[model samples]
Target: MALPENYDYFTREQWRNFHGKNQLNTVTGDELAQIAALNDRISLTDVQEIYVPLRHLIHVYLRRYHQLVEDKADFRGETVAPTPFLIGISGSVAVGKSTTARLLQLLLSRSLPNQKVQLITTDGFLYPNAELNRRGIMARKGFPESYDMEHLLTFLDQVKSYQPGIKVPRYSHQVYDVLPDSYDVIDRPDILIVEGINVLQLPTNQQIYVSDYFDFSIYVDAKAALVEEWYLQRFGVLLDTALQDPLNYYYPYAIGDRQAAFTMARQVWQDVNLKNLREYILPTRNRADLILHKTEHHVIDKIGLRKY
Candidate 1:
């Protein structure tokens, strides 16, 4: 199949076939069991095709990074210093980027013996909902301007510098806001996975894209139609569960009729999510170091690796 500009092609069947042939050989039974334990919610097929290769690529990058540091130390006649590997993972809302980020952190930590791995979501850097309302961008909550980009960049710089116990502000989904006086400290780690919806996008001024700080990046890809369905399904699940909490910002959504709630969710996807994906997210696919293309079932069907 001919792919359009900046796109790569792969069939769903090919991805399944690869998993069938390679799954058993890639990891020991004990290791596979551990991966299954970490990913109890995801299917075994997803674990084999998507998570396995994703973990392998991250391991390869980690190894290469250590080698480079050692080589630099030898050439400069200086002591070796440990540096954190920053990895960016971006995808649309409800595209499972959070789960992927968590899984990668778990797998990578386990892959290395006695190494610390940190996972930080860019959601924490979003402007408070009140701030979004004041800016008249409440409807554009997930857009780039809704984020505290300068602070996020500063945090990344701190991580790069291997600062000791850097405190990061925390955002709460239940309140749809960054909490007051809520912060977590990230002691230096061997790997840091920064996950978000638009982490790879270049700023309007073209000064510094979030991808600039990444040692490696992964873009999770799926058809727009599939993403729409997943978004609605996720909304339904949240409405039945999280949104039911009285303190939840989305509690009102849970009280609505099921069909009405679904409709509202779809409209949000069309007007907000889809618009951002087309205008900002999709355009950055070409900038990824690796792309994980998923099928309708949310299983990765193929991997597109950029020529390094």
Candidate 2:
């Protein structure tokens, strides 16, 4: 299917060529592995050819954003309030959104030596497992209804207000729960990246969509069937690696019947993740400032930037 209206579509080669021979991947193999998500492999060549241009484009946006804010402040005859440039990234479960977020965080931080860039995931804003159970939506974890939207909105509002020491809730992967009284403080970052499956979602409880805070946004795109395959592959890797810890949430699956484990994983994908992707996530793709379309092997094959 063709992309939504008002997009400037570019083949991967064409997009990479825009930067010409000046490109150089500054990150190392170790750094790539550090930022990469499970089952997502990105090479230094990909960084040099793909992400360098994208990073430069973001720099351009940031510059223009600062000027716009200054102009507004001058018009109002008020002191320019220091505000953050927020970027929202959204995508399916296994479409490699985390890796993209981490990669951008690292690249942006390195390039903008004077800027303090922070990356935050919306998983921390999810209702804790106990709350989910009480609400009878534990099975629907990761759905729009599963989040503490008010708390998230408050945090974002404070961040935009340049509120110093704004505390954000922290989620734990090993425990599979939101840690009680845990927070990651945000203190006046020049740029903030909010990446999540539902960052672009319009929640029923709020008048302001989360994307309303975003100066720029990205939607990672790929075929649903490919995402399912990627999700399963990631599950297997987690079983082999992360589940080795006795306290790991998926440890039971790692030690249980392998076929049954795979069955349960497949069931979760078909029932929860895929359903959320189609109903909540895919519909918001056209709202993104840029869409990165991935093909097999997790390679970004095309880029679609909104003209508006």
State the local distance difference test value for candidate 2: 0.90
TM-scores for candidates 1 onward, in order: 0.86, 0.97
16-134, model 2: which lDDT tens digit per residue?
A: 88753385667899999998998997888788777888998898899999999999999999989899999999999988999999999988988887999999999999999999999
lDDT by residue (20-53, candidate 1, tens digit) is 3443423444554553321123555566656665
Stretches off by above 4 angstroms in model 2 are 20-23
Cα RMSD to the true fold for all candidates: 3.9, 1.3
Give the whole-model CA lDDT for all candidates, comma-separated.
0.77, 0.90
